[model samples]
Target: MARESDEVRSGTLPQATGGRRIAWAAVPEAVTAGIERLLGARVVGAVSQPGGFSEGLAARVRLASGGGAFVKAASTLTAPAVAAFHRREIAISRRLPRTVPAPRLLDAYDDGDWVALIFEEIPGRLPAQPWRRDELERVLTAVTDMVRALTPSPVDGALLGGPRLGGWAALANSAGIESGVVKKLEALSPWAARHLDELAALEESAAPALAGQTLLHGDLYPFNILLTAQDVFVVDWPHAWVGAGHCDVVTLLASVSLSGMDPQPIAESHPLTHDLDPAQIDAVLATHSGFLLRIAASAGAEADRHLVDMMVALGLASLRWLRDRL
Candidate 1:
């Protein structure tokens, strides 16, 4: 029998449970009223969507005019980080090429403390867990298409760099093995503790390997992807960044590995990574693993336990995958 954490490691548990969400009705009346004015229709009904780690509003709202739209709103007073993410998403969504599969941003509202965005609601469901091969293929194809469309990113100005790729190096240099992070790593995996130096070196060398002109959906987990009968749509732009195209592919494959499938073959054969140096791929895996570990370690006391568990599982999966490659 497999352990419960094993189910998490394979991507099943988190799919069965989702993050807590703020109900549409729970949003401030003034905020909803403002949203209605922008939508050009009165909101008649609303159903909150789930699956991400934020406690912000994410819902499909019905209009008196019989149309519907997706809404995401957060209060800077309560969730400053989430509000900041919404602000970034608003900026990036405006600049996305028309060809990208993301839903178009219809309207936005920001009044210093509250942020809201309305998007053309996509008609689709999340990709199935245990990942049916056909659906995964469709999503992968869509990801490749998105990468191509986003190359030489259309957005301008200072996009966030992939600094998380340096997590291991930072851990290694911080206060030696007695550091809180080292203690956390040892608690997670003795193997990680034993190989700390090597992992740090691999992650430190990842900077050059990660450089490129492509914009990445930095968080490409299953929750951020939606599948329709004929196409796949990627959503959630809060973490978008410009980097090597393979970085997104690598992140997706790491999530895929949680389905008890071998992601190495796909990683090796995928067009984005197929011709790249094998060592560069290793560096990416190390960087990603370190990144996950760091996030899990630093998760706040108020953090959702389920999401923290998912992060730990995915981090372990990335480490196992990296070990196999080594």
Candidate 2:
């Protein structure tokens, strides 16, 4: 018998598992009908993607006609503002550069109360947790290769972060003001409570310094990256932005560190960040981690039990990293 992949053996692939994802069987009739109409085939079965913190329905669905597509659907009940991001993603993905490694958008569905999106399936594996150096290098290299296309981002539509791509200020400002948010932050780590004010300021300062036209994949964690033999596909565009180069690298750096890998050298070794100021990189780290902490602090952020657990784990880790880095 052949040996199993380490991800199977170690069970440490950085995927979003254990969330309260709505079953495809339970999705609204109109939503299911819409997906069927888009593909011209009835959905026979669905295998949910086990990553990320969204409570929406994300799965690879098999059609009656032997076809498949990655489908994600959300409603106000499952997620609050994420449905808007799904809509935003569809619009932006359609206009992304072809050379970029994102999957193609096949169709979109909206029945007033629910929204769904369909995309070409990405057949690949999540990068190993603790990140294998070779795989980490491969993704970093891919970012460098695609920079020419990613820069001068084809899409100009405003994303969640606005022009400067700075949304963490709101989260930072919530500290001390929101008693509930404070309790959660203190529970995760006292350090977060200690320096949240400064973290907020640092995030605000970094926003203006983020000067570039590149389409930044604001959410670049391992869960959003799909690695196939031929390519590395970056998925999830709801949080994308048109901002400074190597910002994704900064996001990925925090992700790597959270997984127990030391990505400090990646910052200097990767061509994407080779010439960028270290202070700017630090700013990214500080704010990104703070944002994660803010999410972890928020009550009822997601309905999925596992997704919330994943957020809490990563959120605390990100906060700890910020406390140590700053």
lDDT of each: 0.80, 0.71
What digit string (tens of lDDT, one per residue) describes model 2 on residues 210-277? 76788888777788889998789888888877778777877777566655665566667777776877
Clashing pairs in 2: 16-50, 16-51, 18-306, 19-306, 20-304, 20-305
In Å, residue 318's CA in model 2 sits off its true spot by: 4.3
Clashes of each: 1, 6
For candidate 1, the clash count comes to: 1
Per-candidate TM-scores read 0.93, 0.84
Most TM-score-accurate candidate? 1
Q: Please identify model 2 stretches exceeding 4 Å from their true place.
A: 1-15, 77-80, 159-180, 300-305, 315-326
Model 1 Cα lDDT, one tens digit per residue, 33-151 = 99999999999999887557766788999999999999989999998988988998898999999999998999999988889999998888988887888888888888899999998
